[model samples]
Target chain A: MFKELIGKRSAPSKNVIERGAVKKFAEAINDPAPIYIDEKAGKASRYGRNIAPPTFPITLEYGAIEELVLPTKGLIHGEQKFHYKRPLFVGEEVYGVTEIKNYYERTGSFGKMGFLVIERQGTDAQGELIFTEEQIIIINEAARKGMPV
Target chain B: MTAMTEIKVGESLEQMQMPPVTRLDLIKYAGASGDFNPIHTIDEEATNAGLPGIIAHGMWTMGNLAKLFTPYVEDGFIEDYAIRFRNMVFIDDVLTLQAVLYKEEENKREFKVAVVNQKGQEVVNGTVVFRMYEVGMAG
Candidate 1:
């Protein structure tokens, strides 16, 4: 179904991690670690500043690329994996790009479904890879049937 | 305060149970994470989309697992974490999180984690790798 989107890579999008946003995200996730919010604790730690939680980068909204658009009516995330070179620090400007890794169709108890795999790479301002998140999303048959032109 | 001095494979870590997930939590998460996906909040929309009703974000469950390790882990200690959403999570589902020490090497430990609903159904399964500053961080 996403044949044309396979192998397409999105343009690199940049983001600056704000400290307040990191605190809000950590709170939302209900993680109360001092490194994510307490400034005095942050100054005394090894990083010398506030840092984001491990999965914080998942919230970064990179502008969608037209070539990589997929029907989202019934899309649901299936599997996700995160690998990190280091924890992202607040105030660091990072860049990321999304690429369509694979796509396939299979029949299951729920009926025919399409599985799309996407890989996202986050790099620091200096262009070093910080983390990579790979996600697999499944589109049910009903959703696939309603694809837009 | 360190918990352990020696680490062994095939050992069970502490088990934790979380309060039932409520719709209020979902809305708060959406606002904080900036993920306004209706499936996470709007019940009517979720029903229209053929879901069981509003569902919790997969990331929220993953983040809960991370919360279990805050006491023992350094702020940025996670090196790798992966999970598969095995089943859907509905409001009022109380989740139990369990972890087992799967492997150990010099300055590193791997844990296998499972999140199960009250009915003993696995909602999510995953593994996490941690670079330990010292052994026996888990009590």
Candidate 2:
């Protein structure tokens, strides 16, 4: 079976993190580096200021939710993509937009199945363009169980 | 952690975390994503590839971001979305995720959205267009 739902998400406000905070986050992920923690070290690298890791914004996704809602029984990642305009700095405010894209059904093992795709866009404080991301979550029994990994 | 706020179009999500890169994190991510592609799961393979160390499962990082957007409201469910990997997510790097709305209509039921990373990188650029409940529609 296939099900489709469209969502309207408002744009989030800007956020900023200091140099040390970036380092601590990197440390949480077990990263070992000076640029993430050291200012001069960051200046030496392509990033002029302490740069947040690529996945930094993910840390706050759940914080915006007031309830738990998603197809869980047979949801699996179908795809993902990323694009960028500039590197994030230590103290730049950030923002984003997430939209429920589309879904479809096809033949499968258990029966007919469906899948969903979502998109999110992020920006920085100066109103400079940042990056865009698209992701998929499968809600199909066949795709979740029968499909090859 | 800074005060997390509600998401809406025209606004922006800020201060997402982006940690550094490391080896242990790669292995952990390897276990999480179940894609032990030696380059991401093994130091030997990564180093040989001239990479500083083991990379991470791009999805794992993405998944973590997904978690932040949890409790997918009705509008966050399905329609269609796609993303393309831009750069490698090395282990130990704490990445962040952000999305913005492009289109929305409460009366008819529709919205379009996009996402990006802290480095202003478009980790997975795609769109989401889902239907929604009307102003007085009950659950």
Candidate 3:
């Protein structure tokens, strides 16, 4: 099912990485690092402004993969990796795009499954690449086939 | 920042454990990560999807692994982190996150990272690469 998407890229979705969103993300992760939420502490640090947590870019859903839709049910996040040119800062306007990297089928204890690899790239307003997240998602074909759970 | 001179290969960093992965935690993560997939928050939805029950977001589990580095280095110093989700994490499962420095180059250090549930099942496995910077050299 994912065969047609390989090498296909989604349209760029623009976003404003806001401080409030960063705060909510930090709070949700239970990471209370001052640099992520406290502006005073941030200014005193090397970044000179509030920064988002390292994994905060995962929150920019609408900003990436605007047109790439995959089966959501029975899908398991297989693996994830993030490469950063630098820490994403608050108040930055960025755009992200998703590209299908690869796909394959494998058999497991549960049964036959399909693995889909998708990569998301975030770029600043100037179009400089900021960070890229590549994730592998597994689809349980057995479950989708109405086989025994 | 971890003083550039203090880092040594073959040494282990302090191990950290996260609080139990609660159902509420998943809800909070869904809101925070903008990944409100039903399987992560609603048990019935997960059951319908043929899962045991609601599962934690893989990014959340990955973040818990990344959180281990926060105290050792300066804020926002993580250059690269990667993880493979090996097993599903269920509610009430307390995860242990650990990292050990195993390799060193001119300035970069490589650490092996892993997270295990209360029963000692490996939930996540990965590596982190951070190149130490001279104090005041960070941007």
Candidate 4:
């Protein structure tokens, strides 16, 4: 159903990797790693600053595509993958954009399901690639029934 | 710090047993992650959506799964992570994270990772590749 969105890319959105947000995120996950919270530890570490958790990008805002619409309540996050060239420092600005990679339907135990694949890319101010996150959202029959065809 | 030489490809890492999932935990995660999806925090909304009360965000489970590598953070950082949500995680469901070394290289180690509920059913499973710091390198 979302096939028309394939190859569509959104405008770049800005995100600042704030330290307080990083600390809160680290605590929320119950990880007390000093490198993520302690400035001294971070300075001592190779990265020269506090680094964000691997999955911290989930908190960043990605630009939106006008045509992308799905029920937020019933969709399942089926799969996720993140590849980082280097960890994000606590105080850096990243510009991120997302592209609809592919879309398809499958019949699982829950009946007809839709799989929407999107790729988000984050780059530094110089436009250097920092990380890439690919995610698959699963739309069950119930959720798909609510979407616009 | 985990010495690179001591890692064994066939051995399992120490498992992390998390406290039972709580509404407060989900609320805190929702705020921290900027994912305020009500289905993860509101029972009524979840029921209206045909769910069995509130469910945990798959990212929450995925974030917790990365805790398995925290102990080795000083040794290296997680360079790549991939996971599939195998089942829904509900409130009060006790989760445990486990990882077994599946591959070891000169500068990286790979692990087969999983998170299971109290009944031992896998809720999420994936692989993580950790890029190790060169020996004798200062951090």
TM-scores, all candidates, are 0.91, 0.46, 0.89, 0.94
Q: Candidates 1 and 4: which is better by TM-score?
A: 4
Which lDDT values do the candidates have, in the order given? Answer: 0.82, 0.51, 0.80, 0.89
Native RMSD of candidate 4 (Å)? 2.6
* DockQ per candidate: 0.60, 0.07, 0.66, 0.66
Kindly list the per-residue Cα lDDT of model 2 for residues B48-133, writing each as its tens digit.
Answer: 65678765665555444433232232223223333445566655444665555555555222223333444556554444343332
The candidate maximizing TM-score is 4
| Runs in model 4 lying further than 4 Å from the true structure | A147-149, B1-4, B135-139
Clashing pairs in 1: B4-B136
Q: Proportion of native contacts in model 3?
A: 0.70
Candidate 4, A98-136: lDDT as tens digits: 999999999978789889999999999999999999999
Docking category of candidate 1:
medium
lDDT of 2 by residue, A1-149 (tens): 22334564545755555555566566544443564567787676644566665445544331232222554234445576554454456776667667666667667775765666666667766666676666666566533454422
Docking class of 4: medium
What's the true lDDT of residue B67 in model 4? 82
Residue A65 C-alpha lDDT in model 4: 97
Per-residue lDDT of candidate 3, residues A1-149 (tens digit): 57777888878888899998889888888786888888998798777887788788888853434345655466678888888887788999889888899989888797789888989999999989999999898888854564544
Model 3, stretches more than 4 Å misplaced? A62-68, A143-149, B1-5, B72-76, B135-139
- Please give the lDDT score at residue B65 for candidate 1: 76
Best first by lDDT, ranked: 4, 1, 3, 2
Docking class of 2: incorrect
State in Å the error of residue B109, model 4.
0.9
* Clashes per model (N, Cα, C within 3 A): 1, 89, 0, 0
Candidate fnat values, all: 0.70, 0.13, 0.70, 0.77
